[model samples]
Target: MVKKILIVCIGNICRSPTAENLMRDALNHADIEVASAGLAALVDSPIEPTAQAVLEEQGHLPSAHKAVQLTSQTVNRADLILVMEKRHVTGVLGIAPEARGKVFLLGKWQEDREISDPYRQGKPAFVHAYALIEEAVHAWAQRLVG
Candidate 1:
């Protein structure tokens, strides 16, 4: 029933997009589509280079992602929306209060873990975030694909 999934973070260039691409690879479900958007998006931007590099190191060829902003319409379109942190949940609900039921933390299974932003940080930070995202994505994939 979850045909569309949206991942959200502060900026689409980092965590959310990483999770989006990783989920797309992990899910590989024909009926399901995974995408990412930012609470305050760097619209029309590509994935941050460091984040892209971390993904590449793990053999994931990052998609040609153009950052998008979270909107009520986008929120309504998704059967499920996953965010990086608690504030993101607030941000999404502010746009579409009716979506409270569908929005959840990306780390819902990992003790409700929160993924931190690595933008302007460094490769090490991006690497750390990627590991967390990858773990969470696999957990969701198992449930969704099962």
Candidate 2:
């Protein structure tokens, strides 16, 4: 049983937070738990405003999102870890080498794609990132739950 999921990105503000919320919404009734963290987090920053707005448009709330740094403890706790890009997976493995097989691109199931970061980009980039997250999370939820 895949009980715990961890979503990862460069910063917790944009990609990972959105993926976390989308997974939470999709797996609402499942026994799994979902959370997100950053490769290089801001520590105390809230989710980016653009990310929050994009999630809201999808009827998901990101108000509780808080930036967290990826750590060994979190890596050990998660049964699965979905990362925004291949570089994120590489970076995370450098920190927690034991998380080899369990870490993968968020778009791995769909043509082994990578979700690009929209960090300082404008609204359009944020929208694109959000759409990718939503699609990946939905597919992940379906496969894990069913």
Candidate 3:
């Protein structure tokens, strides 16, 4: 059974962190750990303001998450690494070649889409991305819990 889930995106402040926090809230179990990292991390940066606002609106926990770089160690610790886009899969594999079997798109089951980056984009963009992350996380939770 899966225990650790690592979510990935471009910067960790926008998409991945949203997925991480939402998943943590949804799963709400101590045995399962949810975390996030970035391909080109903003390192030490907190979750984007608009992203945090969107999460707050949804009644999810507002995380004070610092951006972390994706590393080989992080890759190994994760039982499942769900990335926001296809390119992220390539970057993670480069860090830990053996992570192949465990990595997947966050939106893989739902049309295999990419959750867009909403860094400089306005609240609307963040809102839309948050919705996508929520949907994707719920889909994953159902699958993983089974």
Candidate 4:
């Protein structure tokens, strides 16, 4: 059973944090742990407001998620790693080559799509990203804990 999941993106303040929370809520299994990180994080910043608003719209209030940087330790701790894009795979593996088998695109089961970041683009971009993230997270939840 996968005990720990890590979501990764460019900045921890947007897509990844959103994915992390959504996955956690979707799974809602006590034994699982969900977290997120950025290859190049904003470091201690809060989640983007647009992203937060979209999450609330979906009935899941955003948590106090502070940006965390991706490190070898965090990568190693993850039983599974879900990244937002293809290039992110390179970044995670560069941190820990042994993670290759465990790292996967979050949208791998959703036709291998990429979840784009919608930082300052306002509500529409955030909603679009949230839809993709919600689908991917739900797909993963079914696979991981169903």
lDDT of candidate 3 over 10-29, digit per residue (tens)? 88889998999999988885
Tens digit per residue, CA lDDT, model 1, 1-146: 89999999987999999999999999875579998899999999999998988899999988899999999999999999999999899999999999989999999999999999999988899999999999999999998988
lDDT winner among the candidates?
1
Q: lDDT by residue for model 4 over 1-146, one digit each (tens)?
A: 79999999988998999999899888775689999999999999999888888888889977799999999999999999999999999999999999989999999998989988788888889999999998999899988877
Summing lDDT over every window of 10 consecutive residues in candidate 1, give the lowest-scoring window.
27-36
Superposed Cα RMSD, model 2 = 0.8
Once superposed on the true structure, which residue ranges of model 2 sit more than 4 Å away at CA? none
* Winner of 1 and 4 under lDDT: 1
lDDT of each structure? 0.93, 0.90, 0.91, 0.92
Error of 2 at 49 (Å): 0.2
The residue pairs found clashing in candidate 1 are: none
Candidate 1 lDDT score at position 48: 92
The C-alpha stretches of model 4 lying farther than 4 A from their native spots are none
Residue 65 lDDT, candidate 1, scale 0-100 = 93
Better of 1 and 3 by TM-score: 1
Clash tally for model 2: 0
Candidate 1 C-alpha error for residue 8, in Å = 0.4
Per-residue alpha-carbon lDDT of candidate 2 for residues 34-131, written as tens digits (9 for 90 to 100) = 99999999887899998899889878876587799999999999999999888898988998999999998999888878999898899999999988
Pairs of residues clashing in candidate 4: none
